[model samples]
Target: MLNTHLIMEQIRYHPIVATISIAVGTVLASEVIWKVVQYFRSKREKANRVHEVVVFNELGEICAAQHLWNTRPGSQEPEAAHCRNTHCTLRNVGKIAEQIDRAVYSIDLAIYTFTSFSLADALKRALQRDVSIRIISDGEMVFSSGSQITMLARLGVPVRVPITTYMMHNKFCIIDGVERVEEIRQLRKRKWMRPCYSIAVSGSVNWTRQGLGGNWENCIITADEKLTAMFQAEFNRMWKAFEKTEASLIQPK
Candidate 1:
């Protein structure tokens, strides 16, 4: 049987024993408090997690069909004829442009047809901000009327044409999260936590006025890591397969 009085007397005689007991208790309590804090923090982070998939349709009501239709030659019908008394508000172009504008580090675009002035302006702005941009475009389409691929190249953006007899019919953009990754790394060094953000926007919707507002097209914007990584891999592969020489728009042939 352990004698409590005897134990107390022994501890009193050896102050180090009592000190050790208090230190051990304090350490256990701190560990329990830290675990509770971590539990609540995890719950909060899960609640605020930002994994999303957004779908955009060109023929949808959100698209401004009237503006796009007016841009078409010989389509001089009244605005009411386009939307049938509904508001012709085109938003998909702006949405895609907004995605480009949000890039902090880099943008990899592999597009079939590139003509939308809005999107070109967005890319120009991103370039002005020192954001790295690489474009892989269909060879024939790069020379098509109203194609912005050459214009982007003229602005010093690296543009490549896939060397294939068939068309490079991919319409996708990868928004890299390099800046976010660096931020997370710095935060972790300081014992902080943050979720990284990266995304891929892809679908049948080409970066064109007709595709964004006139045609029946669909595109998806997703932040899934797996999908982004796959798209990144494909972009890297094409970036290599395409000619190493950047296209020159100073003198169009």
Candidate 2:
């Protein structure tokens, strides 16, 4: 009986070991939760990478502004003053145009359509500055004048409209190696006529002024290396499949 009582007393006093084990278990559980959260946060699995991008600065703010068009109704423009500072919006395409015009080394642009006068002029100006330019468009979906392509080519911009089975529906630009899409990256090095920065934009906006002025489109403009590298890889892959027999325009050879 005495031994039994001693054993009971020991069990009651052994709470320290139980407490330590519980504490260890809690710490391990916390670590597992943290790891799980990080895993979901880092792994990218979707082309629609809207969630991956976040507003970290003024440039990010503009991108969020552009994305608002996707969330809001109609072709109405988001109020830039109210939007975050970095998010790109349809109204801010002019800013994108300006960046293109300022490109010194190289420009790689892919779009579904080309008709925006402002953007066309920007590309034209870039060519005149002797900036190396490569442009690709959906030859099958010529919604507007190939003025941007033609102008760039005439000015020595190496342009092509690759015919593809999937509609070549990508609309993007890598100016001085920056990727414009939120969370996407662009990677390439094009020597410029001047040593200036480039701009990249991606979203629903087309090259037409309508897309910029009145159409509902989501877009982001950024110079972040991490983001642009992602886009560059995609552009490179798509460009590889582009037919070499084609000119920038779909006109007869």
Candidate 3:
């Protein structure tokens, strides 16, 4: 009994060591909690960004543009246009249709290879809506099997072809003179430039099924009037040059 009492009474706790251990434990726990919170926050922010890059649908509904790549999947990078991939999943034909459908006045298109039925349908629809529609296509491909030249011509849409030894390889469509309805979203931000029109899309995509659906391609969507003007100028130059030679060069497709 005497030995047991003395042993118990002599036993003491070290406050400094215990307190330091508790403090260290609290710090480690706090760090873990902070890391967990940051992980969730990063996920939430990424989802928001994915939802932000979007385009307007035919029915006036805003939705994320359907993007795809051919060789590799989209890089899933934040704040980028996904053009770095060899192929992109951007819904080319549909987005063009939406841009044309929203056209209040006119649409001028310069395409290298136009073979998309869906795009032809959109052009027809635009013509029906009384939008002034003009198209410039490569001379050789205009009469090809999948070419839309004949269909567009039948729809009363004026179609032109270049008559040079070199290829007219421009691929873009200008809506309402200043509406640059480009498809590829440019990765480089034009700090001096901001949006000028309501809709614009442009990139490496052609109106062909392979170009839009299958090939390794890139495109951009923008609404800058300056860019529109530049593209429109190129279209005008080509259109006029083709017209000068068209009277002698034009043939039934």
Residues 1-253 of candidate 2 have per-residue lDDT tens digits of 3587765665588978757766898999999999998777555322212222212223433355355655556644444444544444433655666568667566788888877766777777776776667777776655355456665555555556665566778888777664322122223443332233435677776777556655555667766656667777777666666757355463522
lDDT of each residue in 1-253, candidate 1, tens digit only: 9799977886889889878987898999999999999999888855533354334443345534445655657653223333442324244455566678877667889999999887898998888887778888887898889999888877777777766699889999987644434543575585543343577889887888677666766677776778887888888788877765344323323
TM-score between model 3 and native: 0.56
C-alpha lDDT score of every prediction, in listed order: 0.71, 0.61, 0.62
Instruction: Tell me the lDDT of candidate 2.
Output: 0.61
Tens digits of per-residue lDDT, candidate 3, 1-253, equal: 4586544444435656656766898999999999999999877744432111322223221122332223335543222144443222334345566677766557888778888776777777788876677778777777778888777776677777767778878778777665223311222333332222433456677777667655656556555657767877787787777886565433535
True-structure RMSD, every candidate = 8.6, 14.4, 17.7
Q: Model 2, which residues run further than 4 Å from truth?
A: 1-91, 142-147, 178-198, 247-253
Query: Of models 2 and 3, which has the larger TM-score?
Result: 3
- Per-prediction tally of clashes: 2, 27, 19
Better of 2 and 3 by lDDT: 3
Ranking by lDDT: 1, 3, 2
Error of 2 at 22 (Å): 64
